[model samples]
Target: MATSRLLRTSAAFLAATALLISGCSSGSSSPDDEASPGLTTEAGAQRPAEEATLAPLPASTPAGLRSYYDQKLTWHACGNGFQCATMKAPLDYSRPEAGDIKLAVARRKATGPGSRLGSLLVNPGGPGGSAIDYLEQYAPQPASIRARYDMAAMDPRGVDHSQPIECLSNKQMDRYTETDQTPDSPAEVNKLTTAFRDFAKGCASRSGKLLSHVSTVEAARDMDMLRAVLGDKKLNFVAASYGTFLGATYAGLYPSRVGRMVLDGAMNPELDSRTTNIEQTAGFDTAFTAFAKDCIKRKNCPLGTKSTQDAGEQLSALFKKLDAHPAATGEDRKLTESLAGTGVIAALYDQRAWPLLRDYLAQAKAGNGRGLLAFSDSYYERSPNGSYSNQMYANPAVNCLDLPPAFTSPEQVRAALPSFRKASPVFGENFAWAALNCAYWPVKPTGTAHRIEAKGAAPILVVGTTRDPATPYIWAKALASQLSSATLLTYDGDGHTAYGRGSTCIDNTINAYLLDGTVPPKHKVCK
Candidate 1:
């Protein structure tokens, strides 16, 4: 599983749950704005200067790619001050003449009393997450920054609107996600592997040729093209979770064009797929331990108010029970151990969902699976009507193409079980199995683990939550160290990413960077 799933799924789960529960749902460089540095104004006023400016292609650009760089975008108003447009990119960069594909783009112009600082591209991980969806529904950029930059996003190719990869039908996906990740018997193992193979075959049958070309390297190239089409001399971006990899790839590819980037919940490009999954398993363990500590402090904690070890054992016990007899949700769906684990893992992404986790756990312990099932559904991007977004399809399409599979066969996973279980007693086995999906991918791997050193890039801020469940904090430290110019900002807190989830120190420091080109001091730490 791509670690980028941390931010998008968890945040979407939070928003969806809030609707189920409550049913609800920048710019000023003036003396007044100066007095209140964070205040923002309406962007309704027209700024003719915001019109598109095509950036010049680099002198070394290949002749075949010149047209892409020179293409002009005609944006049309979508809704709520947002503009929508489409961009054309090569289906296969090596064979540009073969075909072209369209990428969906969205922009919300700067609301400003200050001169525009160009576009600020945003992406919220997922390898499969919709950048446009994030830009419209979730980005929490401060007013000061929004006032000076037109917030923009491009759904990476093979993602949401970018000619997404289609895999299994909704009914098939339901079975795939619930397929046992922890196989006790050979028959169970065969079932699991068969599901994975089916998923891979489904993608090959539907998405076909597109699968081979959706690698991160290609996505980064697409982003640079996006920057040129937006007329920005340098690309200014804020990417989280899997998006960090995309941003880092961009930096590695176009170091000279790096501008004001913030990679929150950053990923380390140096690790192989197995190591990534193992480390992510450890991350979830860390997050769950933290949750256990918090849970014990609360009165109705379902795992019992004893030690965290005991809590882990209790949760493990519950999972075992469900493995034998799946808990029935209100609907036809049952909460199997796989879905239950997904639910628990989803809640671990955000501390704000701890109470909900507690409630879900309580309900699950009592045989009601609805709560946890809801979380699993959100993680899978499964709608109430039983349709799934293409996230699962795109996620593996990108991950498998980017790196070799963690395990080539079931025997390999069984061999690694010891290390994985040591890293995460509760989640290790399942994660180890989850990593096996790519082994059955129709396309061979095109990328290998390596360090990314954006040699001449401007100082990039990388934020890491000390207890992030998806992209571990260690990745942030590693990425910051790898980048030629990077500053590590540590949030000694919980949750996936740090920028807009709530931390004045973290937010203020990032706001300064995005607004006034202020770089935070080295080794900055926020509580």
Candidate 2:
């Protein structure tokens, strides 16, 4: 969940876990068309049975899946020092021989004398975040796990380096995001509706068939294929934000395949889009409150006086000011209220960005919006050359397809405005309207908010930061409660996620589990 729009961007309150496995067997036309792959029975051996009940084992893979499970990957030199390879999976699982999609995978080999634990797949949230970039940056997957496990990363089906989803043209996207999210006039509302309709049309035109197939459940199935191609008997994974939902789907669909999974900044799979957005609205409000409390203490704090309430009012007023008169960046870009809000939301993702946000707001108040515009630009993944990646485009595409829209129409959104306002006074109206983007989507939702009881799965660690803005903290609690074999690990701190940000307790706890079989107690809380 890349918060601001990325959380709302990807999470969109869709909770997009509408993954349906149907029978235990693959979705192939004929269950007996081919023999099932030899999946391991080891996950049940050491899995914790703390929950009242467990989900049944997934049916064995069909014979047609043999090529996918038995293919050998040829790793080669890629960017920097990491090894890279291409793995192939069927575009439609129901028709295995119809077509295929290429997946880009990158890995840093285990540098250790300790026994190799196998490949540890990692995802840095963003249903759209480039796992390749994350792995290349080496921001996640700490050294301990790296020492004994091959740190592997894969770009999901409709993400970077894979068969990515592309929507509006660069110019159209700029227009789309700049549309008044908190529309006041009827004309503005219609313009907003057009923006969404046109954007969805662009995706339908550009993405075509891929648009209908990139569900989180399908992505999870891709992961199982990746695991088999990598020659691993069990899946060892580290997923954050939306990735958590993907992992949960995997475990629920293939419980016997889960091995040493960690879901950081978990997303609750059981919550619907509106409920998810409402809760996330409150989550951001909470994070902003924390930031406001800290900001008022600093010298030259920009959001007016010391009270969080007063600070919120000041920020709200500033949004109104920008809504009327957008600020100019050094370039042609203007800081529309939407862009400014994105800037503010981007900074809220990491506590380390607050001081900079304060400075940006101060400059913005002084008629200089370069810094804040830069923040928004980064959030939008817009390049200075007026080019852009498919991140922002794919984020909503995955989100909209995974789960139904939070609000189906402008009327519905208008009706729910009060509830949204109550949830997040500063961001409610805009987010409420932003939630309407999916209403005009070209593709029907493939998933829904459902329980992910990954019964018989190995001990999975679920991490939650108390003040995580993107994926609400309570989401972790809810997810842990839903997963029959999950262990809840709480971090009472600031930031979107809690692992590998210099917290020894959190890192050690996760590392110990990845290294050995030491799951933390149910209520383990770390500072």
Candidate 3:
């Protein structure tokens, strides 16, 4: 769910040369140039598309945002012993009284004698990650932290249980996940194009009226409403990957309301879609280099190559082989370039998965790709029943709304391929085309790339992992430099996020900040 444009810069290279570049803060409008409170077809009626952009409230106090956060929430028991609630927010903030949309909220109250620090709202990076599921399955904080805070989450607008977005059926989704991300020839390119078209059509047919309204800015507004309704004096949040962008947007829109915020694996909001793709391509290439460097030093490197470049060449050859003849998984599934790439990408997210990736690649080299195929299945969140979740569907719905597509034509992308390849030779081609997903999008973007200068915001902590694949390390530095009151925390590790992933130093540092309103020293590095 993270918006990645593959870049080839290594974490070490970025760290050594990281510069504090000023982010462009100009106010830009949507491309379609539609006026505010525009009307669009909804269900059976012509309803006004929610276009109210609320200015920050007059009061500078954190409590001011909460005073406006007034709403009645109806709670119910839902999913895995968590208490879920539905709260109504205006379809458009411009007209708070016009009509309301329901937000699905879930929470597990703090257990303890510790004084409460208020609600700790959390989002797990996916533009489509189920926050409620994250809270239930992954977020088990220290008793000291848990006992003092009400851990909570919401399925952001258009996500699961919150007017969910559905694009493809089980059959269609399987085909989609199998669609070749890396197209090597004219025929492959045509196949990729058709896949994109079919995927878009499925979204159009299923999501209907909801797709247009699922941008990041809108989701940020939804967060504000959730904060208000939850009776929080200020927004306390922990967001990773794409969620970092959401939190940053919140800080930009409502600077004074930010409280105890942590943006892990921060995204670079300053980059346009093209640059984003290029940088991410390079990021994957860099990660691949790291993997290759380590793999060659191991006893069982499948490629048996002495140098990283040779390992890369070997992998590329393997992809070409797969392009001609996809490997069978010994099950109903098969391994194509796209699925294989996804399997590699899944390992890139967490350093812990590197061993598994090595073994999977070894199996794949033997013409038995079941191991890699299984890894890809987990990354896609495919179940044994072949029923896939709506993560990918909702991912694009939200992303397309957040920013405009990088390029609208394959020709334009081809023109830029040289630069993209320069940035990340390993992943440039795939990411270049992936950016085209929004080209045929049913809805138009409502925002553009700009510097987030939350001039009056509280001290926001921006955490960056040294070798994060989804959100490259430079993004953390970029975001920190852009924000007026941001403190950058560096984690020299490989993963999408640093907190709660078994780093005592990272966890303790963040916990101290959240609990005591303490900001880490500028350019603080934690190993």
lDDT of 1 by residue, 278-355 (tens): 777888988999999999987799999988999999999999999999999989889999899998988888888888
- Could you tell me how far off, in angstroms, the CA of residue 270 lies in candidate 1 after the best superposition? 0.5
TM-score of every model versus the real structure: 0.92, 0.90, 0.87
Best model per lDDT = 1
Candidate 3 versus truth, CA RMSD in Å, comes to 10.3
For candidate 3, lDDT tens digit of each residue in 262-341?
A: 99888877766666666667667767887888899988998675899888888877877876788889988788877887
| lDDT of model 2, residue 125 | 73
Cα lDDT listed for each candidate: 0.83, 0.78, 0.72
lDDT of 2 at 195: 80
Q: Report the lDDT tens digits of candidate 2 across residue range 1-527.
A: 12225642222111111212111111112111111111111111111223233244346778878889888999998966699999999999889999999999999889887889999998877778788877776345566777899989999988989989998788877877777788889998898888888888889999999998888888889999899888899999988788888888899989998899999999977666776777778778888998999998877889866699999999999888999999988877788888888889877877767777899999999878888877777777777787777887778888888878987788998988888888888988877888888888888997776778876789999998878888877778778888889998887777787776656778888889989979987677777
- Quality of model 3 by C-alpha lDDT: 0.72
TM-score, model 2 to reference:
0.90
User: Model 3 segments beyond 4 Å from truth?
Assistant: 1-68, 79-81, 95-98
Go through the candidates in order and give the C-alpha RMSD of each one to the true structure.
9.9, 10.9, 10.3
TM-score of 3: 0.87
Runs with alpha carbons beyond 4 Å of true place in candidate 2: 1-4, 8-57
lDDT of 2: 0.78
